[model samples]
Target: MDKIERIEIAVIGAGLGGAAAAALLDDAGFVAHTFEQAPGFDRLGAGIHIGPNVMKVFRQIGLEDELARIGSHPSHWFSRDGTTGEYLSEIPLGDYALKEYGAPYITIHRGDMHATQIARLDKSRLHFGFRLSDIVEQDDGVLLTFENGRKVLAGLVIGADGINSVIREKLLGAERPRFSGWIGHRALVDMNKLRSTGLDYERCVKWWWEQSRHIMAYATKSDGSEYYYVTGVPVDSWEHSESFVDSSREEMDAIFGGSHPMVQGLIDATESVTKWPFWNRDPMGLWSRGRLVMLGDACHPMRPHMAQGAGMAIEDAAVLTRCLTMTGVQDYATAFQLYENTRRARATKVQTISNANTWLKDPEDPAWVYAYDPMNVELN
Candidate 1:
């Protein structure tokens, strides 16, 4: 495919979502550029699930093989009792997803997925150390100002920045994301360490549901390591900041140190933990205004209970590329509207369902979520 020389798209915040959107745009022969706030490695922490809905998008973008190499398909999803470590229910994902959804339910480190998309994105199109400060709409396009006193212009802007999005604030109004009143504790255990305690590292994605909190553990990558996440009540009620805070093993011990041995042992083995409060934003009444639009967390951030964050952003990129198949600014408006119409309800449903069932979802959710394909779908 010949590259389109004239700039058409400007992606704000070169995280996984932004980078994936840029790559898909480039694949569509559009001149798409990206500006990122931080240097490399800004999103180096945490882990995420790459479900079939995500893989379906990746399959369309020609990167499923790489994702497969970096991630492993979970055999099943097991819901267990946090206090007793007894199974509550289970659903097969490894073979079932492949057979039903034409993709795998893989789990990988969030950083790995981000890095994969970044590698696929054209480096010449990426501008680093460019934090977005403001967006000024113009007759032909939008003028974006960066904190570094630089300006760039493109026919349209896509905000793939995370929950705290400056583009969203400028495009819409400033809005606060709601906290779920649970502090998240996350850590990665090397396969060696997991084996040291005979932990099941690759059997399934395990969820230990308690009253108001839960523990989720799964294999992060093929490198013989496990990624574990535990949700617990905050030590203090004074509204805790949602930023990830470095915490000690001792501090975590005060929370889950004495649960069932598997849960407690997992906490005890964690060398360090970064605790953060889970926060999510409700879907906006509108996702686009004129030439500016939003995607991923900027548009629809949901709880990790459903593990669709990365997949949703990638789906946004793929669908945006498909919708923005023309050159004119008028085409951008149509594309933006079509993108939002196609995505808003689906993303909102995931947000609502995940929030409703924090640790479990309806049996129909897997089919509704995993069997989705962005490429061949009709827009709402």
Candidate 2:
């Protein structure tokens, strides 16, 4: 039997953040396990853009080529008017990311990306169906109580559980996440229908930002299937997913109804549409308490305008591993503090910038976001 060391890490939530954290710990010779509330992986959501900063992390993990082969590589990001269909501004995406950032800019179906990362992980380390019910920090490690009535003790527990995290409430009290007053409707349409509509399925991500709504679509999935997401500034809060399911299509169409033909067409293509009020946290005041720490959305959930939510998680995995390697557990305090110091500023920056990007009618320059490079820095 291979001698398994007793280094235990409990990653709450098996979303991309939790999975990445687990993988990084495993790579660093720790016994890391992930517990996700969801019973199993189900393909949810339409698509997500993967900026190069996240790609660089994949490169280090040896999964870049596989991801690149499966996702759509766009040359640039462009903006246009949702109604007039007029070009606004564009930014180079391909060679620029490769040369300047050392990785490629791509977009893939959110589900596909999730599956790719999950597949690369050691199956033995992942514990599905272990929904976190509560957590408490002890002198030696963190204690986690799961919905299954089982208990887990670990040297460290990281909350990658996401925006409505139970671990966050356990550690920091039950605080409500701020609703952004937005309902997002997303779907994937057949590539043939997208092309026949005269939409350029290539040339980078295209966004049609209108007065009160923002609509964007991009080619995704392994095969070039495209996706569209429309968000209307919400007028009220939705109590549950059932509320979204019960919303009237006429009401949905009223909000996004007259944006543009292409926008309307994409919404029409959906077999059925789902809508919900979006919520996210600005950077939290504290990320760690005792051996418990928070990562990604659980720590710093932000608006999706900059597309760095997953990128931040990937970066967290790297920095967390670096901290563990450099500062051994003899000084877990110093090591955990170092992890926070190394990550807090950058994570907050992404959170701030992503929230700010939503209001920019046209960005002359990408500013806070354009200059980030993940591979250039190594924490020692």
Candidate 3:
């Protein structure tokens, strides 16, 4: 009879952060298992941008070529006026990222990226429908109790369950997700349907921004077959949570009512749209609580103005693995402290800036964000 190896790390949640954390730890010689509340693997709601910062992590982990093949590579990020479509500013992304940051700015559907990483993991180690109930710290490890009444003993716990995380509330006390008074409507449209509008669908990521409202569209597939679009507008109040039932065209029109023709055409091309009320968290000085530590949205959920919620999580996972490797997993106190030391400042800064500037503004210089490398960065 074969002996089953005990999991050394328990990663709560199977979203991007949780799955990626498990993959990174497993690659670094840790027996990590991901526990997800969902019974089966599925796609999250929208498309996502992978900045150079996060791409470098994928490059080092040997998924760069695979990512490049499946995702869209945009040459620039173009900002324009929402009503007039006048160019405000431009930033290089595609080759710029490859040459300067050693990676490419890739965009892909959320499901594709999650599935790619999940496929690399040992399926036997993944447990679904194990909703977290409570975590009890022990001298040797931590005991995790799931709502299903199953208990698991793991040497370490990573809280990557995302916003409204059960682990964070249990470990750090209850924290509510602060709504940003913003409603985000997102859709994926066929590029061919939008090509007749005469907008340069392949030129750059076209962002149309107006006061209190903005919209952006980009090609999401390599062959320019589909475009990912998101429109953000301020609401007086947001009682609705995130959902994706079919919306009336009148409702869609009301969101971006007076947008430019180019923007409207993109909207018209969209057949389905999902809306999610933007939510974020206040800055935390630290996210470590003894043997348990938090990462991603579970720790620092930020506004989407920066398009970096996933980037920060991936960076956190990489730096955390490095910290554990350096401090030795037995000394989790030192490891978690080191991880927080390296991540807290960066995460807080992104959260602050993303919240303060909730619209896509042309950066005076974006290298501060795009050029950062977690591997080479010093632990502040």
Clashing pairs in 1: none
- Model 2: CA > 4 A from native: 1-7, 196-200, 241-252, 357-360, 367-380
Worst 10 residues of 2 by lDDT: 1-10
TM-score preference between candidates 1 and 3, better one: 3
Evaluated with lDDT, which candidate comes out highest? 3
Please state every model's RMSD to the true fold in angstroms. Answer: 3.6, 3.4, 2.6
Tens-digit lDDT string for candidate 2 (286-353):
88777777888888888777778888877887777668767765565677788788788888987887
TM-score of each: 0.92, 0.90, 0.94
Ranking by lDDT: 3, 1, 2
> Which candidate has the highest TM-score of all?
3
Candidate 1 residue 207 Cα shift, in angstroms, is 0.5
Candidates' lDDT values, in order? 0.77, 0.73, 0.81
Q: After superposition, how far is residue 150 of candidate 3 from its true place, in Å?
A: 1.9
Output the TM-score of candidate 3: 0.94
lDDT of 1: 0.77
The list of candidate 3 runs beyond 4 A from truth reads 1-6, 196-200, 241-246, 358-360
